[model samples]
Target: MKKFQPQPGFVVQAYKFALDPNAGQGAALRSHCGAARTAYNWAVGWVTASWWQRRAEETYGIGADELTQWRPWSLPALRKAFNEAKHTDPRFAGWWAENSKEAYSTGLANAAAAFDNYAKSKNGRRKGRRMGMPRFKSKRKARLACRFTTGVIRIEAAARHVTLPRLGIIRIHEPARGLLDRVQAQAARILSATVRHERGRWFVSFQTEVKREIRRVTRPDTAVGIDLGVKTLAVMADSTGEIREVPNPRHLDSALKLLRLASRTVSRRQGPDRRTGQKASKRWEKANAHRNRVHHRVANLRADALHKLTTAVAAEYGTVVIEDLNVAGMLRNRCLARQIADAGFGEIRRQLTYKTRQNGCRIVTADRWFPSSKTCSGCGAVKAKLPLHVRTYECDACGLVLDRDDNAARNLAALAAAAATGTGVAGDQGTLKRVSKPRGADQKTRATRPRRKAGTGRAGGAILPHQRQTETRDRTQAEALTLW
Candidate 1:
């Protein structure tokens, strides 16, 4: 398949709006999502059947040459086999035609991608964590979503409704004049629409290729470094020596009491039990929905805050410098996980990435081990150790006392300056060289073996073997432990 390449001056974007479908339309939407799930499950079962058959045959001492042929999981293969069997297959025989064909294709496409990922991971061709074989999705746990790439997908002239394949016109909760005007002016072309059921509401996202006009930042020659933390959402230090802090709203923490109360109320009601074949009482469903609403509100608030913060920063600065934080590793700290997650560190970086592009600003990511907080902004001296508990950075060399986050943000800003000047800053000697990992480099750990000689100690004299073999935790581990 050919990869999609947007035309010059055009970028792909998604415009999502909450749907306010009536009862009949809601049911139809559910049907389409159900059709997608059904198709996915069927594909999984059909492909894995041959695997089970081959395994059983081998156990019976059957020769490899006589084993059943393996099933293909490519989209075209799955579609061809599904079409041949849909008429006779009891699973989809009667109601397969109720929803648009795109519903089934979405599932098949997903299954194919899942299988491909599994294959790549197993062969060590994929990055990140390993993947397992595709499994059947449970009706109770699976997300409800369906994508339509064809058949009259459009925003109605009223800008208050959208039309999808087979589902016809459905009302939306908010006006879509932004997207409608663009579409009417031919500045954006809708490529597909995806309907998803989330947070007890239906939403449709239109994927489009939009010709965006990139605007210059307010301060075209300025650079700003952002230091993300739990106490403060972000501490930004600009090249002009202006420092600002965006306070953490702590939305989740503030709503914890309400969430706890709602959860306790839900526990008192008779909830569903799959093993017992008991359905939830209406009171239980209502209580559960209330709890979900609390979560939804928190999520919405966080997203809104992050978007506003990122947009402002991206629009004001010509260059934005952010740390390449190991957020996954940071989450492993039990004490700060909830607070860190609530701060939306990863989400902030993701939004800034695209937002900066649209604002015609450059974003520079500092190396994960850049030691931003440990580096002093006054004399450019890098500290050997700066514990998290020490919120005030006291520079040993220059006697400069400053807030820890403020110092870090200033140090980060210096990195951008160094890049622009093509000269190494005091604390960023090897930063450019270390930005990208060398080919075939092993993943780094937060610990290191002491570099002492087999019988030597810190004084460089002979020492015991046991003492020589003592392991040393890097600054990363020390900081992690301090945070914990």
Candidate 2:
């Protein structure tokens, strides 16, 4: 696949602002969102019916030539079919013209992407989380959203109001001076706008092609190593031997009491019973909204804290090294899951990645199995076992004691040092690659051996030397087993 190369001086960025829509405008926003959801559900049903028809035909022993071809799930095909049936389809015939055409297009685009992702995942061609087949969206559970691409999406000169295609001039809660100044100065162009209702309030986000100015770090040659944990959000050690520890806010843990109280209040109210077709009472709706607001506040607080932390680090350092943490595996620990998640390890790395590139800085990620915490930073000694309960690292070889996270951070900083000196095998000038562990005459651990040195019969992280030496001498005999 060809890589996407953005224009030299331009970058794509999004600006989101909270909206303060009046009652009528709020209702209109909800209506558009509902229309989008309806369109998505209709598309899903249509595709599912087509699949079932094909399956039924095959079961009836229909000839291959006579069987109906499977209906296409592409956006263009779905749009053509929907447009032809809208005038006669009972579900949409009455209200088809009430909303903008962009609403339907958004739903169709999403449906196409969903089907494509499902196919890729089923065929083992997709990465990350596996996706199931496209499912119908529920009105109550579905998030309210709609996007407008070919519309008059602009910020007013006054910097307090904005104009969308159909939804004209909605007031904003915060001043949009940053985006407005760019638009007025011809430094940015708005390409699309998405409006959504989230956490009991309305927000509009503009996707723009912005001309970004190159940024420089305060300390251009300084490299910092960051170690992330539940107790401390980040433990950073710079090239100057300075260590700074940022404490974890533990937002979720702090709010658990209020959350529990609010949840109890919601439970006491009369909620909707889906099986009995009973609607929720007003008290239930009010209680649910209150609970949602609390959750939203917690999210906002966490995001604000993370942004400040990442921005400062990215702006001050030229090179930042962080661990390639297995956050998914870490979350499996029930005892630390909530605290680890609240620390936002994944989010911090994601932000740092973009921020470093946007500025003229670089980021280096250590390999997952590098064993940073188990190694002694003072004397380059590797320990076979280091339990989580041990907060301080005590080196047996050098008798040097230090904080566990601080030792790891210092080890990560050594990687930067190696890369800077041109001694490490860093593939790219800016990207510091993983290096092999140094060989020691007294080393007994097979897990630390380099890939080339570790013999053929390796499984897991260790290799048994005697078992592998016998197999290498009888290579022809081992190959004969494949014939059977």
Whole-model lDDT per candidate: 0.85, 0.82
Residue 380, candidate 1: alpha-carbon lDDT:
84
Worst 10 residues of 2 by lDDT: 475-484
RMSD after Cα superposition, model 2 = 11.1
lDDT by residue (58-143, candidate 1, tens digit) is 89999867877666677888999999988999989899999999999999999988877775555455688988878999998999
Pull out the clashing pairs in model 1: 455-463
Clashing pairs in 2: none
Measured on C-alpha atoms, candidate 2 has an lDDT of: 0.82
- Per-residue alpha-carbon lDDT of model 2 for 102-150, expressed as tens digits? 9888888898788777655544556889888789998879999999998
**Where does model 1 exceed 4 Å of error?**
1-7, 423-484
Worst 10 residues of 1 by lDDT: 473-482
- Evaluated with lDDT, which candidate comes out highest? 1
The positional error of residue 455 in candidate 2, measured at the CA in angstroms, is 40
